[model samples]
Target: MLIDEVPERAVRRAGAAIELPEGLLVLDADSGEFGRMPKPVADAKIRGLSFDGARMVLVGGRGTCLLRLADGEQCWYGIPEERYDEHADLSPDGRTIAILTCDEENAIISLLDPETGRRRDIWSDPGTASHECEIRWSPAGRTIAATYMIWDDEMDDDALSTVVVDAADGRVLAGPFIRTHLLGGWLTADLLSFREEYDDLHRLQRLDTTTGEVITGPTIPGRVWAAVAGRHVHEVDELEDHHAEDTTFYTTDIGFADRRPLFTLQPKVEVRYFFLAAGVSLPPSR
Candidate 1:
């Protein structure tokens, strides 16, 4: 269902949520009913949803807050004095939260404790700025993959890079890999899928974080809008008719086999921001 004037949306394994101008429209997976939950903080933006759809992270003009869907319980992060343009992701185990924040000079990734409202910076890179600054936690919750737009003073342009770090102590495990963008969640604890420009076409590729091995996957037929759960690839294709377009959201294995079409959007709408709960099965589109 396309919602007019909705600015943001997030999809989980069991349901989905839309950010309306008034409030958050939540689709309850268990009841198969829709409900509206007032934003915990005024003008807060939905950063991410937990795997089970029980909790969500929101960032607002004030700070970031964690909302419990069961009772609307709220836990605000301790860093209210810091930047407001932060992005957050809840760990799979529901114990830790990853927060990505950046300023004009540096990019920072930190871990937060929901219960105690404590935060610790895990990694910080000076002289680099973030583009999307999206972070994804591995299935085991042991590592994080982050996207950044690094400024290249020599090239006089910004370059895309993906960095993988240890979730525990902020050790660099794999990258600051240049010119690669993370495709989806981790396929495994060590494997990540990404895309790189190859002869003017965007081609899917896989990286083994442990061994520094790279493997080229299938060539994408159209532009890949998003990838989720390391298996489903959301693609947008311009139709032959100029006035309309088609957006195909499908799921496939790591090898791009056993392809399945989950849903398609005709006369495509511009999706400015959308996120899928990583490592979770998306309920079949109804």
Candidate 2:
């Protein structure tokens, strides 16, 4: 089935907020209609959405603002003068927000209280030059995982790493694992799945935060987009015609068996990221 309501050029900036050139279109999944379209701010960029899809974080030339989708209420959080490429993720409960900010010499992770717009710096990489910082809260909101690409002067190439930190106090829990990138989902509250590259291949693996154990899972195809919830994998099917007017999204088991068509979009939307709604249950992997 094709969804004509979705604009062909609409980009999923983060969460349920679809990015248009002028502003954002909030999709109400339950109502099957577009919710209030928030007015565009100067150089507005959608950062992320709350777990329940009722609120979103937007950053622009002025600063960062938290917008409530139901009533258009806005909460402004001042932007740091030294920060560049700031990214934010709302906690599952929507009370706390994890913000990652990077500059030429350091990357800083901080916690923000949405109610009062107060912020506390939790973690910082003092001398490392880092960018593309992405942060996510664990399912239970007890920990946060941050993945970022760093300039590896020793290797003379860009490398990736993932770090897990205690959400309450920013205690380093498991990693700043080299060459590992979080796959955007946790298998369990303490078990995180990520993509590891070695021997010229990319493989899926899980890390145990409590016991510091690593479990290698499976080798992922080059075209796979992301491994979600440790159960299903989403990928672009290269076997299908790439130039078709409609684009199909497919999901497979963890092992890449039993592929199923999830949905098709007319006019072919170019998607860089996809997020599942909160509390959506997926079938067990075979």
Off by over 4 Å in 1: 1-14, 18-27, 31-42, 78-85, 128-131, 197-199, 222-230, 239-247, 265-267
Worst 10 residues of 1 by lDDT: 5-14
- lDDT string for model 2 (1-286, tens) is 3344544232222234444333444455554444334354556556666666667676655556777755567787886777653667788888898877665677777888988888887887643323344677887899998887666677787777788899888889887877777775565667777876453555777788889898877766534544445455464544446556765556666665777765554555565544444443332221
lDDT of 1 by residue, 1-286 (tens): 4433333433232255545455565666665544455555676777777877777777765566777766667877655354544677889888998877766677778788887878888897753434355678887888998876777566677776778999999998887877777776577767887775233556677888878888887766544444555565555456323554554556677777777776554436554444555534564654
Following a full C-alpha superposition, what root-mean-square deviation does model 1 have from the true structure?
4.2
Which residue segments of model 2 deviate by more than 4 Å? Answer: 1-27, 32-42, 127-131, 197-199, 221-230, 237-245, 280-286
Per-model RMSD to reference:
4.2, 4.6
Model 2 scores what on Cα lDDT?
Answer: 0.63
